[model samples]
Target: MEMKIGSKSNKIKYYFLVPALTVLIFMTIVPLIFSLGVSFTNYSPTRIGSWSFIGFENFIRTFTDSEIGTSFINNVIFVVVSVTIEFVLGMVIALLLNRKIRGISFIRTMFLLPMMVTPVAVGLMWRWLLNTDYGLLNYFIEQVFGITSINWLGSYSLAMPSIILVDIWKWTPFMILSLLAGLQSLSQEPIEAARIDGASNWQIFRYVTLPRLKNIIFVILLIRTIDCLTRSFDVVWTLTNGGPGLSTELLSLRIYRLAFKFWETGYASAVSWLYLLLVIFITTRFISYLYKQEF
Candidate 1:
C-alpha cells in the first residue's frame, strides 16, 4: 500500500510539471527554432505572401555590410569602456561604503536611485539635461568656465561618449550592490589573521580580500557583459536614435532598425542569431571559468 501511494504521488508530480515544461518550450524553444529557420531565408515583411530560402546569404551580408560593421565596432567599444568604468567605480564605492561610517545606509540608498529609474526615463532625463542651449549641464559649463553651449547628443564626436556616460551612471549602482554583498558575506577569519600578522591595508586587500572575492567579481562581470551587449536599446534609442550618422548605434539598436524600420526580416534574423551566438560564446567562457573556480 505504501509503495502504491508513493507511485501515485510521483505521478501527480509529473502531471503538475508537464504543463509548465510545455509552456517553457513553447515560449522559448519554439521562437528560437522558428527564428533560426527564418535567418536562412529571404523573408522581408514588406513583401508579403512570397519568400524563398537563400541559405547563408544573409549571414554573408552581415559580415560584408559596412553599416553593420560600424555598429558592431561601436558595440564592442561601448561594452568594454562602460563595463570597465562601472566595475572600477563600483568597487571603489563598495569599499568606501563597507567601512563602518555613519549614515552609510542613506548614502547607499542615494547611490542606487539612478538604477531604480526606468531606462527610457533616465535616457529622457539625461537628454534634457545635456541639451545644448537650455540644458543645465551646458548652462553650468557656460556660467562656470565661460564656454558656449556644447551639443552633446547632436555632435558626432561626443554622441557615443555621452551614451556611455549615461550607461555608466545608470548601471554602476548594480555593480556596487553586487560587490558590496560579496564583501559583506566574506568570512572575516582570513582578514583578521592577516591583520594580526601585521599585514598592511593594501596588502590584505590584494592578497586576502581580492582572492576571496574572485568568484563574485567574475559573476558580476558575466552578468553585466550579457546585459550591456544585448539589452542596451532603450537608452540609445531614446537619446540619439542612432543619429549623428550611426555613431552610437549598438548591435541591438541596429537589429531593431533593420527589422522594424527597413523590414529586412531575414537579414535582421541572421544578425540577431549571430549576436546571440557571440553572447553565448562569451557567457559560456565565463561559465567555464566560474565552474573551474567552484570545483
Candidate 2:
C-alpha cells in the first residue's frame, strides 16, 4: 500500500510538470534546434524554396568578416567600460545610501527612476536630449560654457561615448541596489572590529567589506555582462541604429543587420551561434571561479 501511494504521488507530480515541460520543448528547444539547423544552410527568405546546405561557409564568414570583427570589438569595449563605470558609481552610491542619514530613503527611490524606465523609452528620451539643435544639453552648454553644436550622436568619437553614458545612467541604479543589499546583509562585527583597530574607512572597505561582498559583485557583473551582450538591442537600435560607420555597432546590431537588413539569414545565424558560444565560455569561467572558491 505504501509503495503504491509513493508511485501515485510521483506520477501526479510528473503530471503537473507535463504542461511546463511541453511548453519548454516547443518554445525554447524547438526554436534553438531550428536555428541551429538553419545556421548550416544558405537560407534566405528572398530565395523562397531555393536555399541549399552550405556547410560551414556561413561559419567561415562569421570568423573572417571585418564588420563582424569591428562589431565584436565594439561590444567588448562597451561591456568592459560601461560595467566598470557602473560598478564604481554604484559602489559609491551604495556606500552613501547604506548610511542612516536624513531623506536617504527618498534619495534611494529617486535613484531608481532612471533604471525603471523602459530601455526603448530611455533611448527615445536621450535621443531628444542629446540632439545638437534645440537640445536641452546643447542649450545648457551654450549658456554655461559658450559651447555650441555639440553633436553627441552624430560624431563617430562621441556617439559610442554617448551610448555608454546613457547605459551608465540607466543601469548604475541596478548595481547600487545590488551592492546595497550585499552591504546591509553583511555582519557588523568585523566592520566594528576593524574600526576599533584604528583602521580608516577606506582600509575597512578595501580589506573587510570588499572581500565579503565578492559573491554579490561577481553575480551582478555576470548578470549585467550577459544582459548587455544579448538584450542590449532596443536602446542601441533606437539611439543610433549602429550608425556613424559602425562605430557604435555591437554584435547584436550586426546580427540584426545581417539577418534582416541584408537578408543574409544563414550567416547571421552562424554569427549568433558564435556569439552564444562566447557568452557560454565567459559564464563557464565565472562559474568555475565560484566553484574553486567554494572548495
Candidate 3:
C-alpha cells in the first residue's frame, strides 16, 4: 500500500503563514522584548556610558515616588468618573436615537461627527474653547451666571475635572455608537412578547432590554475604559500638559513625560511595562467574559 503523504503535506502547509507571522513578531515582539530588557537597566540614550542594570529598582521607585503615586491615584479617579459619566450620557443618546423618527439617518450621522474627528484636533479645539481669557465656554458661563475669566484649565482644583469633561465630550459618541449598534441589533420578538404580557415600558426596558444588552455593555466598558486610560494623552496634554501641578497626569502622559522630558528611558520602560500589564489584564478579563457568555 502506498503511504499517503497527506500528513506531511498538511504539516508543511503552515509554512505559508511564516512570512506574515515573522512580520508580526518583528513589529510587536521585538519592541516588547526591547522594552522589557530595558526596564531592568538604566538605558537612557543620552547617558549611554552611565547605563547599568538596576533590576527592580525602577519598579520600586515607581511605587515609592510621590509623583507617580499622585498621578496613579488621579488617573484612577479620572477613569472611573469620566467613564461613568460617558456611559450614562452615551446610553441616553443611544436610546433617543434608536427610535424610528424623522431625519434619523442625518441626525445619527451628525452625532458621529465627534467620534470621527482626530483626537489632536479635538484637543486643540477644546483648548481654545477652555481658554480662561476668551474661551466660548467661559464667555457663555459669564453671560449666564455673571462671572468673568474663570480658569477652566488653569485652576489646579478644576484642571482634572475639566479634562474629564473634555474626554466625555469627545468620547461619549463612541459609547453612543456602540450602544446604538447593539440596540439596533436586538430582536424585537422578546420585546413584543414582554409588552403583550402586561409589562410596562420601564419594566420591559429593565427586564428585557438591559438583560440582552449586558454583553455589549461589558465589551464597551472594557474598550472605553482602556481608551480612557491610554488615549487621554491628546486632550489632557493639549489642555493642561499634565499640569496645574500634575493634576491631569494620566498613565500615558506620565509615561511620555518620563521617557521624553526627563529621558529616564529604563524607568519609563518599567512604567510602560506596567501600563501594558494593566491593558493585558483588562483585555483578558473582557475576553473571558465574552467566552463565558458564548458558552
Candidate 4:
C-alpha cells in the first residue's frame, strides 16, 4: 500500500512538473540555443530556410560597422548618464518624501503616478509637449520665455537628451520607490543614534544611512539596468525609433532594425547576443561586488 501511494504521488508530481519543464525547454532553452545557432549563420527569409555557418563573422562585422560602432558608443553614454541621473534624482526625491512631512503619503503617491503611466503613453505625452511647432513646450518657450522653438527630436544634439528626459520623468519614480523601500527597511536605532551624536544630515546619511542601503541600491540598479536596456522599446520606438540617422539607435533598437527592417536575422541575432552579454557582464560585476550581501 505504501509503495503504491508513493508511486502515485511521484507520478502526480512528474505529471504536474513535466509540462512546465517542457514549456521551459521549448520556449526558453530551445529558442536560446536556436538564436545562438542563428547568430553563427546567414539565416534570413531570403535564404529559403537555409543556413551557412560563418563563425563570429556576424559579430565581427557588427562591431566593425561604423554606424553600429557609433550606436554602441551612444548606448554606453545613455546607460551611464541616464542611470546616474535617475538614481541621484530619485534618491533625492525618496529622501525628501521619507521625512514625515504633512500629506507626505499623498505626495508619494503623486510622485509614483509617472511610473504608473504606460511607457508608450509617456512617450506620446512628452512628444506632444516637446513638439517644435505649436507644442506646449515650444509655445511656452517662444511666448513666455522669449526663446526659439527647439527641434528636440529632429536635432541630433537634442534627440538623445529628449529620450533621457522622458525616461527620467517616467523612471525616477522607480528609483524613488526602490530607495524608499530601503529607507523604510532601515532600523531606526542607528539613525536616532546619529541624531543624538550631533551629526549633520549629511554626516548621518553618509555614515549611517548609505551603508545599510547598499544592497537595495545595488538591486535596483541591477533591475533598472536590465529594464532600461530591454524594455526601453515603447519610449524610444514611439519617440525616435532610433532616428535622426541612427543618433539614438540603442542596441535593442539596432537589433530590432536588423531583424525587422533590414531582414538580417543572423546579424540581428549577433547584435542581440552581444548586447545581452554586455548587460549580463555589467550586472554580473555589480552582483559579484556584493555577492555575499548582508541582506
Top of the candidates by lDDT: 1
Backbone clashes (count) for model 3? 0
lDDT of 3 by residue, 169-207 (tens): 888888898999999999999999999999999898788
For model 2, give the 10-residue run with minimal summed lDDT: 286-295
Error of 3 at 146 (Å): 1.4
lDDT of 4 by residue, 24-46 (tens): 99999999999999999989977
**Candidate 1 structure quality by residue, lDDT tens digits, 21-101:** 999999999999988999999898789889999999999999999999999999999999999999999999899889788
lDDT (10s digit) by residue, model 2, range 73-126: 999999989999999999998998897889878888998999889999999999
TM-score of 1: 0.94
Model 1 lDDT, residue 245, Cα: 93
Query: What value does the lDDT take at residue 91 in candidate 3?
Result: 93
CA error at residue 182 for candidate 1, angstroms: 1.4
Give stretches of model 2 more than 4 Å off: 290-295
Of candidates 3 and 2, the better by lDDT: 2
Q: Backbone collision count in every prediction?
A: 0, 0, 0, 0
Q: In candidate 4, which residue pairs clash?
A: none
Model 4, TM vs. native: 0.91
Q: Which candidate tops TM-score?
A: 2
Model 1 — which ten-residue stretch has the worst lDDT? 286-295
Q: Which pairs of residues have clashing backbones in candidate 2?
A: none
Q: Relative to the unseen true structure, what is the C-alpha lDDT of residue 250 in candidate 3, on a scale of 0 to 100?
A: 80
